[model samples]
Target chain A: MIEDKNQQRTNLSELGEFGLIKHLTKNFEINQPSTFKGIGDDAAVLDFKDKKAVISTDLLIEGVHFDLAYMPLKHLGYKSVVVNLSDIYAMNAKPTQITVSVAVSNRFPLEALEELFDGITLAAKEYTIDVIGGDTTSSQKGLIISITAIGEAEESELVYRNGAKSNDLLVVTGDIGSAYMGLQVLEREKQVFQVNPNNQPDLDAYTYIIERQLKPEARKDIRTLLHALEVKPTSMIDISDGLSSEIIHICKQSEVGCNLYEDKLPLDPQLINVCEEFNIDSTTVAINGGEDYELLFTISMDDYDKIKGNPNFTVIGHMTPESEGIHLVTRANTKIPLKARGWNALNG
Target chain B: MIEDKNQQRTNLSELGEFGLIKHLTKNFEINQPSTFKGIGDDAAVLDFKDKKAVISTDLLIEGVHFDLAYMPLKHLGYKSVVVNLSDIYAMNAKPTQITVSVAVSNRFPLEALEELFDGITLAAKEYTIDVIGGDTTSSQKGLIISITAIGEAEESELVYRNGAKSNDLLVVTGDIGSAYMGLQVLEREKQVFQVNPNNQPDLDAYTYIIERQLKPEARKDIRTLLHALEVKPTSMIDISDGLSSEIIHICKQSEVGCNLYEDKLPLDPQLINVCEEFNIDSTTVAINGGEDYELLFTISMDDYDKIKGNPNFTVIGHMTPESEGIHLVTRANTKIPLKARGWNALNG
Candidate 1:
């Protein structure tokens, strides 16, 4: 984190609520043809025509969902959009518009909000989405953000979490556990900085993991890639809460069971090295670590040949009958029952 | 507010996040045919087909938007949904679905949330809306609620705030200033109770005004009535931020000035009586007190004969050329420039 001690502070009340919203959103350009009207209206109008509309929402609160000690306002803004958009991609849809609402205390200045919106505008540009509408208000405590993402897709191309069959192959996109490890690294650095303000710790070795934690990208390209391969997933879900927890969701909703192979869980080399340095089990982190923003889905056994050598995909497991129950097949040929050890915000 | 001193308390972590969501939303039925899939997948699917979709969102924070001492959780839940739906109705659209997301601290028991959801369910039933999806998690401080309402309308029937033309009559639905007076009464009672816990003051006279504050209704019936009368509003907005602020929004966006008559401002009998008791100006409260949830719109002067003596509608003003500027015509035949003095949450 870069701290600027000489930054100028502008009071939010000087501009009022309307002036603040107008100033913050003045640079956001609407590029979606479906968004007939955006901002400046009581409600946004969208003409999805023949396509089906898909909607998802999330609420992120300070101290519970994130800590400002290590999280920059810009990255928090970018990651907030990514997390919501990840759900749209998990459903085989293209996101076209989003509504962003934020509540902050007077401890924040106008420049801080501008930096947050800069990241939002950047994400909207990168993902080709329109910033349709939002509400800005004051919080009695820390900052709170709520986002609602809207997307559209043809009826035939849509996917849900209840279509998996017994013989389907479970697949995961990209690597897992990297984001969780990145958070650990940041936490450690935060502790070090707290003990000694003059100490400047070198973070060159943690660049990748830290970036993964801060700027994790959503798998927006997976839908197009799967479309080109002619492989439509039977059941799909985003890996927001670790691999084992997501597998459980698919199995329970589809009325089937799954056997996940520990050896098949994709892990980046840096994540493995970091886990060793931290003296934590790599397999345990891979199975229970969350915030990967990757797609986890089950496809028909017949489609294995189509994705056999795809670098972006890893065949992690297979589905079984509902009577068998869910289990994890370790590399040592041991079967252990899987449990949902994903991060629980409420438990905190 | 009703307080149960010996109410049973169940820890939220006992059910976990998923179980808590399932238990809370189990009673929400999908009444709209447009909702293809709800609450079980990464996103909810809606088939709008050929009709245009209208979406609006709002964020409510404790201490800033409401006071828990004077507002019950159930009433809070119902009012949260009503505020969002009011925006959709302002566009002359039929609200069909809503997604509610809430963040609360662990101090709130599961039963407290159940009471909140009971209010939400009742509002959903009354408005014929489907609670499609939402996210529930922990907050670090007070409660936070975010809601997004989705509706549908034909292209010709949809309204915006920038469609008002010169010579259009400014019309308001029902009455105003009652909800604000209701809040004043509640606040006074709360203070009185704090000074003497055993004192139980009679509140029979303020029932209507109190209900106006606790459980305001959106204008869902106005659309059907307007359709039956073969009339469409030129421009429309909901009165959440009081009348003066809303009028400024219309005049600035539509590029038309307005002359609001002081004599024609709507005021209920209870609101007048309460204003006298509190020694506050009724006209000032009518124009600057927010959260009324009524519809304000502009209609062509030619349609004046169509709604001349209608009991539900009141014509308070008419639009003029932009050069004339916006003003309030007083009973003394004095023209004073209008200002936006509506409640600013951020300014708090």
Candidate 2:
């Protein structure tokens, strides 16, 4: 549906498997000292020395996780890397290497894969991580991308989801719900395009929301920022599955209930406007929308003074005893029980 | 086509994504010292300490890599992890942890996934590795599995493909070609079964070959054996893409040539019988067949005496200067150039 007309198409058979891998990764630069060896061997060798290694993996399937109609190949590749790296950042670690495995059907031309790799290379460079190793092969149907990100952190610096305690302050980085709104806008435009392919979408007002959806950057600078502020999170998790779900995860693992303040929930101005345009509730979107890629974490109440007015962070709420149950305090001073309305890929 | 007639089926959406992951990996035991924290977090934390880390990843898509008509879910899961771990063993590292990501269509019931994870758990127990993390999601088509294996070894003990030198003796552990023949037997059976569903063809004679194809094991004991013999390989690689392709890889990377002895190519007795029955060349299958999961490496001449006469290994060739091209020295006193007929996943 999104095929580019006038573009050069090269059959994947022209390069074969090994030839394609070599051609795609030939320009990948290895700048990480931790990477003792990169691609070209059976496995990539890494030297973490005294530091701890943090590993995370994610799988992205076409039609299930993304639609090619609105999601460009390059954007899809970039998002894949960023999402995996977000998990590392959630652990307060510095991502050092990534292994990307892609399985594409014959329907995708060589140029399409080149575009995907170009995005991967760009993200690796931008994140200052080495593209260590990967596998590329054919699929029977649509494209599939699996990325494993490796990061390094000192043993003492790492955070886990079970460290939060009752009364800890809940803090989130940046805004939420923008990516979900961006997806909504894109979906609407896709339907409009289906009706009239000649119609050009003038999406100037949706610039921020669309960028949030298409090119959402991980909170790479938050680790340094938190360190500079002398604040270590008691527990942390990335907001990939919406605020309500992540809050539930932290609560369940940390054995604490939370009072998430609806008034304090960070929502992008663009997201608010888009929700109004779509006649959706901004608070519901902020709490239940997914793919914000923001950092939702808990810090000791003692550190709240240090981050009181920081623009990068929003003091969302505070943890409570498990018996209190998880709730969102609305602006009307009424508390409502929160439910995990996150995107469930398996439900699709 | 291979579905059980009376197997219990449970929808996956009933458990949701988080509950399904929790259920599938609840039985995984963490026994590795390197694994500090496993699942229940955004990323797994590993303490590699002073050891170097080896990482490798592979993606297996249904139909492209295996046919479910003959491949069981459990065996498929086991083979997927084994294949990836084989890459780590090829680097002379002991695999410690792995992250598995799977995407399956709604057609796959919860019972099928349980069977698949059961095999993953079994392989982890057999290999003594930790199933640290993974992702489970739905696909639009068939099943897709991506696994990244992490191993560790001392810097001095690690091996790479570029360490081979001229005059080094090439050796291979165990036998080759049986796995390819096993696949042939299974394919033929599948075809026959299609013609008559109730036909029960005897497969006793093809037991070993079928087992090799369906439930192959990686050479995890080779490293210990080589260490006990006090012989460090100059260069090493796993035979995942047939003998000739791996030889070419080592030769090209190490800047050396090889003279492989056709008569010395290791072949199982069952493979010979099967080749005779199928009217195929045993030598060709030995050199060109894939998925043997055996170790192919070169050791310096000084270590040859230490490894010679070992029943687990066979000296198949010797490295030569780059000026001499790679060739096969036949027992009939004829030198024929070697060609790589490795399975190309992208070709299909």
Give one digit per residue, the lDDT tens place, for model 1 in B1-348.
445452799999999999999999999999998898988899999988888999999999999999888788899999999999999999999999999999999889999899899999999999999999989999988899999999999999999999999999999999998998899899999889899888887889999999999999998999998888888999999999899999999999999999999999999988999999998878888888888999999999888888889888999999999999998898897998888973443134
Model 1, residue B283: distance off in Å is 0.7
lDDT of 1 by residue, A1-348 (tens): 444342889999999999999999998899999998999989999999999999999999999888888888888889999999999999999999999999999999999898888888889999999999999999999999999999999999999999999989999999999899999998898888889877787888878888888899999999999999999999999998888889999999999999999999999999999999998888888888899999999999999999999999999999999999999999998998888864442133
| TM-score of predicted chain B versus true chain B for each candidate | 0.97, 0.97
- Please write out the lDDT profile of model 2 over residues A1-348, one tens digit for every residue: 343552789999999799999999987999999999999999999999999999999999999898989888888889999999999999999999999999999989899999899899999989999999999999988999999999999999999898999999999999999999999999999999999998889999999999999999999999999999999999999999899999999999999999999899888888888989998888888888899999999999999999999999999999999999999999999998888973442123
Candidate 1 matches the true fold with a TM-score of 0.98
TM-score of chain A of each: 0.97, 0.97
Alpha-carbon local distance difference test for all models: 0.91, 0.92
Docking class of 1: high
